[model samples]
Target: MSDSGPSTPPSPDEKPAKVQFNDNFAGKLILPTEEEIQNDPYRRRASSRRVSRRMSKALAIADILEQERQYVIGDIIDLDTIVEADDIEEATTRTRRFSSVVAASRKSQASTKDWRELEEAGDESSGEDEDYLIEWEGPEDPKNPYNWSKLYRFFCLFTVSMQGFCVAFYSSSYTAGIPGMMAEFGITNRTITVLGVSAYLFGMGVAPLILAPLSEMYGRRIVYIIGMASFTIFIIPACVAKNIQTIIIIRFLGAVSGSVGISNAPGTIADIYQSADERSKAFAVFAITAMNGPPLGTIIGGVLFRYLGWRSINYFSLIAAGIFFVAGFFVAETYGPHILREKARHRRLTTGDDKYFSRFDFPPATSLATLLRRNFKRPLKMLFTEAICLAWALYLSVIYALLYMSFIAYPVVFMGLRGWEPQIAGLGFVGILIGTSAGVATDPLSRWGVRRHKVDPETGKIPPEALIWFACVGAVLASIGLWIFAWTCDPGIVKPWVFCILAGIPYGLGTTVVFTNGWNYLLSSYSIYAASAMAGNAISRSFLGGILPLFAPKMYSNLSPAIASTILATLATALMPIPFIFYFWGKHFRERSPMLLALAAQSGI
Candidate 1:
């Protein structure tokens, strides 16, 4: 049997971990930093090693599975198969991960389970050498999520994808009902009415701080079910809200409950698909749904608001939420740790062996408060302290804020000025959808770029910087599109409307490119800490999304359409070189930043 002992002792200055890495894990291994070789793999699933809020849910699931266990539970993401995907930075923020807090616990292995005991690829991590362990029956085990039938896997994927789509759709669709809301409440202030959307975003931003730990502790399914149910229930109040305050509060509550879909969908995909090819495809589908849902929301909202009034939009989200609430109940528990514990329980019940135990068989050593504090603090710390985190956080916030701002700007341009009906005006956002589709179509080109880029001679993994070229292209495209949209959107001109609307194609495509590539860039660059960086990014974006819309009505009202948009265009143009700057010098900064270090320890490059 291979020795399960940890790698060479840590230097005095570094923190110690009770983890051991195989000299060769499969054919390739990217050795983990001492930090990546952690005591609690559960924490990593939710935070340090993850992407956005729920993006890391997949990684957390896969990363935990990647840990060698005497009791194997479908080892996922071979070191070389860097688990990366989706423009879900907001979908799965770092603040929502359980590890942001508990991951800091480098305590003894008593409370943790199978995660702690692998002696080698062939053995489990053990406190006692004599304790026997159980592993996968083989690669063919039906219990393994990866080995499940394609039809079943697809079913699971569809449900989770719908969940994400619903959450994203809620974002833009809410903007459409503002006019009805203003009329019903007899409010004249655009900023006050827009506060409804802002409130919803704020709930999404804040609720994850608590949900992150709950999902890890309870498993992802419960969170989804409860969240969906709460979301569905909360919308009822808003539907018949007597005052704007009620709509604002209920929307906030609904969003808090609704966030589970965005927060856990990525992990569900990660849990089900371990192959990089399959995972990438899964994320693409997820990304497309999330992106597409937002743009299409305006069209739907327009028709609903025009025909049934603003209440119809919430009714629609509620109905969708209700359907998923029922569906969520049928979904199986996908958290690897939870699954293993169940398997271990079955073994002990049938065989009557007291030693039958999973890694997390015992209760957690850390308290809820500790988990909360850690999860909350680490991501915020990285947001400010880490250069990569701060830059990406600010960049993504601006991008998302600008998109939300468009909700106000588009209506102002198309409806207020052009004398277009709400139904007709809502169609304006379809351009963005078309642009996103165009962006997704470029995957082949991105793949070619990845292949063409210089690879690590040792690991054969494409460097993270290879993703920057597309980002640069996206930045330029986004700026040009925004500029076109701005200049052509003059309120006084009629012929320019077509040109202005057409500009959304480039803007949508450009934003899609930046979000998608930028997300992957962080994944490749910050091997483990990507979760925190992404979490901070989401928080900032939500903050901006909530606040920026308030400025939109005012800015567009006070300034000429071209001038207002040009101010935004200038910002986009200024950011166009960000990717280029990172492409050349990001590595130097990445190497020096304590938070952004690439854990090149895995050999599977």
Candidate 2:
């Protein structure tokens, strides 16, 4: 043998010779022949070592690819092919290329996942480091206002509604103190004193054109707090005012600040409740509180003015503002974009990442001036351009004007004709309160109608027109109530109790249904633009509220109470067709308008 001369053991690094089996040896192992071992002793060892190294390298690459898949794809990986693969280099190359393709596909698809995975994959492909965006962790994320616990949501609703009630209460409550104000100031003209009310209502209408957009930009919480705080603080000047002009000016400013809650409350409710069905009930409660506030405030002001003083009304307002101010602290931010922006800011601060942002984050239309200009003009544009908005605005404005005129009408009927004191006359509002309560109680029926009308038999989706049914029924009821009130206003024709109890109840009931349903319909029809639509409603109502009362004294004096009342009733009867028209033809009108089409698309209608 070649090595026989040495007859030495193999070095430690060298492999031992292998045993081999004969082709047809019948389960017998055959040692390698001496000639074969001498020919290639280390060949099997070298080949085995090379195969082991190659497999280890392939497994390592598979592990890296699997890790990349997890980071990129955000789901479990399938590893059967890599595990079963036989050719190491081929599997490694194929897997590496395939994983890269899968990653690219995932990036391009951008499936809905948490922000973390999207950020990582985005960074990897671009080969540039980027900060992560902040978003809801998932659809059920509790931080989302829509996903908040029921108790918390109700608390928020209650707080905001209370704010609205306080502001609205302030709007008409002080009318009770007007007589005392005239006596104290020694002024003769009632029109001059009524200017206080007119100015306040005008302020309420105009301020929302600006404030609603600010709420959208900043947040509901900040706007509410600042507005309530200013409203509360301004009550002092009005209470101590020595001159009519001073009181009127202070009241206007207070009204301006207080109007913020009115414009923003619907938006907050929309933010909290995404479904029309869910929102209907919340809006019913909201409508009840808002509808009841003026009458309730009149009741409170009558009692306070009789017992305490004229100034006590302002004091009561201050107390209400304080309560809402403290409660405002607990109110969470409800605007979706504002909430997301805040989340983005928190993420950037914590991660020390500059690229973190929200989809809502943008350059904001070049400048603050442009942003404000667009926002300020939006409500006007919606008011004038959209038929749905115009019809609803006209209907609401007329109804609201009639409602304010009732302030004068009630006094004329109860105090002037029936020779009752101011406090007793204020009791006529009890019928309205009863009607509002009835409306609140009947809201479930409206919701049922909405469900029945809106739900697709197959898809279970609600159409926007579903909201108009209640409005239609409300128009009929409101018309009947107006006619009853008009024909029955005379004490000679019917007892005061008859109109007060019978007529006022239906009037209140019909008014509540119309307002609540109309508001809900507008909200549904213009989902993202609901705030601007509401602002339009507010402007029309407030404008009518201010202007209508000025003519109340003349209308009742010039035309007999019966004729004046009939005029209002006739107008109401004429407009009764509005809701019905909208119910049948609203969709066609919406289709015709590009603004409505865009809104419908945004709402996925």
Candidate 3:
């Protein structure tokens, strides 16, 4: 070989020679022999192309390795082994292994895959010596709520549910005090006194539109703390208020603060239970507590008002709110994104590295205002645009309206017709409590029904619409109960116990089933946006619950209790078809909805 360095550019007419290397040759620069240079034009072109491609690949691999170093700290790279490789083939082989490891690590970072996928992937790679991403640290990470001890999870669930129960208890408990409030404030119009309760429900509806998103931005703990504390504090003023306006305004504010528990509790349940079956049980308990609170409040309030006085109702709520506030401290943060974000922050601080971040960490570039605007608009947008949300909201709203109207209807029958005192009349609500309990007890049946209709036979995962089966049954019962109660409420027709047991129990069962199933369907269908969907449900239900009672007295008086209630029963009967329609065709509706389609794709349904 000659050591000459200069080579002239080829003319347009001349073809470049190809270059060839020995099988054992390393990637060392070499001068060409005069004979080889003169004869090998095509080989020269091929050699140049090979060198360019290798250089590009090396640069790309270096970039990937650097990124891995920044985000992951471990035996992920072996620089010494690569540097010691004696030939291009050896180096290329090692680089391919590194690339494969990096690709596997990136795949593990993905959050959309279900637990089965993760387990299967683990089995497939059992023999490989690799450093996969540590998303949940082998599924036993204490930080992951899904891995929490059952006792601890139950405690958390109970605490959160209690918070919801307190708010709901206070919502209707005030109704029993309305007489005292009217007399004290010298309010002649019953409508004005009723506004005190309506104002609170309206606040409950509107506040969730803001607070639910705030809980997502901040953690659930902070929201619960602030909300419960404010609620407790506000009760003091309402208890001593001289005017009805003060009571109404303060009650509204208190309800707004307390709304956080109602809005975020379902999301907390989602965090703890990864499977729909487990979540259904939790939701059943939550639904039962929520449904029973109003009736329980009615009972408590009537007793307190009759014996201790009306202001004692506020004192009772104050005590409950205080207990919830203290309990809030022990309730762990169950929001997954919030937990991951905190983990990322801790890791970054401990490692002194900014790149150790969780996938859920919000972008630093995003502004608070932008986050608020997006989150605030999401629930309303879902309510109006998503077919599933719109239909379910309407269904839940009507059911909730009927439930509130029962407070009015019961008094009409037992007090106005039977001439029962307030305390005895309040006992009528026990039928609702019994029915709600019965509905909760049947959740296992609903779960079995869902499994029977599994969308994926292999995985046994059911569609969201599977929940509507309970709703369908509940609707029929509700319609029948309404008609029965309307007709049997007459004084001479049958005993009072007949209406209480036959009509109230079935109505209670039906309403609880509808509420529970509706919530489950919404939560499952919109998992990522569960809170937003819940906010929509709250808005519709509270709005109708508040407005429906305003007309109850007028309705009973103008049309007579039988005709008035029958009209409601007819409407309830008309709505009976809604759950059935959704049960059969909901999937089609979801397929057409862009939002539902995107959510389904994310959840791998």
How high is each candidate's TM-score?
A: 0.79, 0.73, 0.73
lDDT by residue for model 3 (143-229), tens: 888989999999988988899999999998888887788788788777777787788889898886677556656878888899999
Model 1 TM-score is 0.79
Candidate 2 accuracy as lDDT: 0.67
Candidate 1, residues 246-307, lDDT tens digits: the string is 98888888888888787667777778887657876776777788788888888799889999
In the predicted model 2, the residue pairs found to clash are none
- Runs in model 1 lying further than 4 Å from the true structure: 1-134, 346-354, 360-364, 456-460, 491-494, 596-605
Give each model's whole-structure lDDT: 0.67, 0.67, 0.67
Tens-digit lDDT string for candidate 2 (19-50): 22124321111223334434664633333223
What would the TM-score be for candidate 3 when compared with the true structure?
0.73
Superposed on all Cα atoms, model 1 deviates from the true structure by an RMSD in Å of 10.5
**Which candidate would rank higher by TM-score, 1 or 3?**
1
lDDT of 3: 0.67
* Model 1 lDDT at residue 317: 85
